[model samples]
Target: MTVRPITITGEPVLHRPTRPVTSFDEELRQLVADMFETMDLANGVGLAATQVGVDLRLFTYAFANDDDAPDRGVVINPRLVLGKISEEDPDRDEEAEGCLSVPGLSFPLKRAEQATVSYQDEDGVQRRFEAHGWFARVMQHETDHLDGKLYVDRLNKRWSAKARKAIKREGWGVPGNTWLPGRDEDPFGH
Candidate 1:
């Protein structure tokens, strides 16, 4: 397994939808392993294929639920069915979300309180499960990446402005920008 460099926002691969995983071969398995290695090193709960410059629709996640139980695995070609988005404003303190691709900043964004995801596993076996709370949030966040949407893109006007400023200040939003875990400093402060 290798820790690949994570792409920043505005990179073409991260901004466009990825192709589905059709071959469940050893190469795909190796990519999944590399993604997990990269995600763990960067201290991210989820890392999508596009984040690492791979245009395949898959993501690796390792997050603990509200009960503190570990929920860790990979999802390929996911079809996420989200519950109604909460009308209540996102509690900034509780709902702030950050991206490994956009590191170091987290912005508040309201999201569905529950979600159900159907996807294939490493062996091309189909699976489905429901989630809630932070786990649900992770599912939604990662699935959005598959559709070429970042969490910042869904921010409201106020938060969007803030995110935009930060992106500019950091000199991001361009192609060929990446941060390698275990080599570069973790802007996410992991």
Candidate 2:
């Protein structure tokens, strides 16, 4: 599988909602394999089709829980169900999140602690499962990408301003722009 170049933020495909993947053919399988390879090369936990310039509703994720047990899968045309967060839960942490599109920048974003997602597998079989902690956050992040939303859009006013400034300073707001993760020098030192 080839590692496709990741489309940066401000690209039209990254801003617009993706189309559903209706065909589960060899092409779709190849795309999934390429996405996984690209994500691994970029050291990303999750990646959406839009991030790779494919306007299809699909994403791949590779995550390990606290015990180091691995979980990896592909979600096509996913429907996400978020669990309610308890205000009284002191253990809940607003962790910093980064995106493959908006590379080199991270912001502390609060996401649902748990979520259930329904999606089709590569073979077009239906599947549903729940995720928690960092895995849950990754699912929500990738789902946002499919819906034409970015983590920077969910940032608060203070962090939003910072993100905008960084984008402008780095000249990354141009449409159709892209950068290679390891090859390019990260402005934020990642």
Candidate 3:
């Protein structure tokens, strides 16, 4: 498997809604493998097809576990069918998340505590799986990417401020000396 370069924040493809995958050909399978490779190499838990400049609705995610174990796999044309809500918002449990596209920076974000998702597995078999805790968060994060969303958009005001400053300092979207604070930071800070 080959590692594909991840597209950065300014790339228009990252925001464009992904097209559904129509074929599960060898190329698509290989792409999934390569995505896993790249994600592993970059120490990312999830990656979306659009992050690699592909417009298809595909993603790979791995649950973060000790012993350096990799629970790696893919989802093709996946759709979220259900989620569980605890008395506490699962996503409000803040943890540091990093992205392959947005390199060299890690910031805090919240993710769902539990979720039940139904999607087509690699062999075109329909599968329904229940996940909670870290696995649920990974699924939520990667699935959001398929819908053209990013975790940074979920940061609270204080966290968003810090994240935006770091993103800008890393030169993510702006030319040298250009400061676009409002666009750079999460205005809503939800």
Candidate 4:
């Protein structure tokens, strides 16, 4: 598997909705493998198809759950169901989120504390999984990608303005802006 360059936020592919995964074949398997590799190399919890310039409704995640248990898998053609969000989070600072597409910058955003995702695996087997706390955020974030929304898009005014400045400073948000995980300098500074 090869590590693909993750597209920056302004790319058209990331702005539009992704197509659903239909054939669970060898090609799909290869793509998932490559995405996992890319996500790991970039030290990301989750990576979506649009981030890698693929317009499919699939994402690979490899991160410990909210309970510190190892949770890793690919979600294909997912439908995410979210629980109520607590607006007044005492640990609100912990909710700051970043994206591979946006590279280094992070901004605090509200997200559901619980989520249930119904999806298919790489083999096309249907499955449903529930997540709580930060894992729920991961699921929600990745699901947003499939619908052409980025974490930055959901940021509140204060953070959104700051995020916009950062994007402009980095010369990102343009088509064809990408960085290879290992080869290129990490904009987020690892």
Candidate 2 local lDDT, 93-146, one digit each (tens): 457888889887877777888888889999999888878888888889999999
Candidates ranked by lDDT: 1, 4, 2, 3
Question: Whose TM-score is greatest here?
Answer: 1
Model 4 reaches what TM-score against the true structure? 0.94
Q: What is the TM-score of each candidate against the true structure?
A: 0.96, 0.89, 0.78, 0.94
Clashing pairs in 3: 91-111
lDDT of each: 0.91, 0.84, 0.68, 0.89
Ordering by TM-score = 1, 4, 2, 3
lDDT-superior candidate, 3 or 4: 4
| Weakest lDDT window of 10 consecutive positions for candidate 4 | 85-94
For model 1, the stretches where C-alpha displacement exceeds 4 angstroms are: 66-70
List of clashing residue pairs for candidate 4: none
Q: 9-29, model 4: which lDDT tens digit per residue? A: 889999999999999999999
Model 3: per-residue lDDT, tens digit, 54-96? 8888888877543222376687777764464443322333567
Off by over 4 Å in 4: 66-70, 89-92
How close is each model in CA RMSD to the real structure?
1.7, 3.1, 7.5, 1.9
When 1 and 4 are scored with TM-score, the better candidate is 1
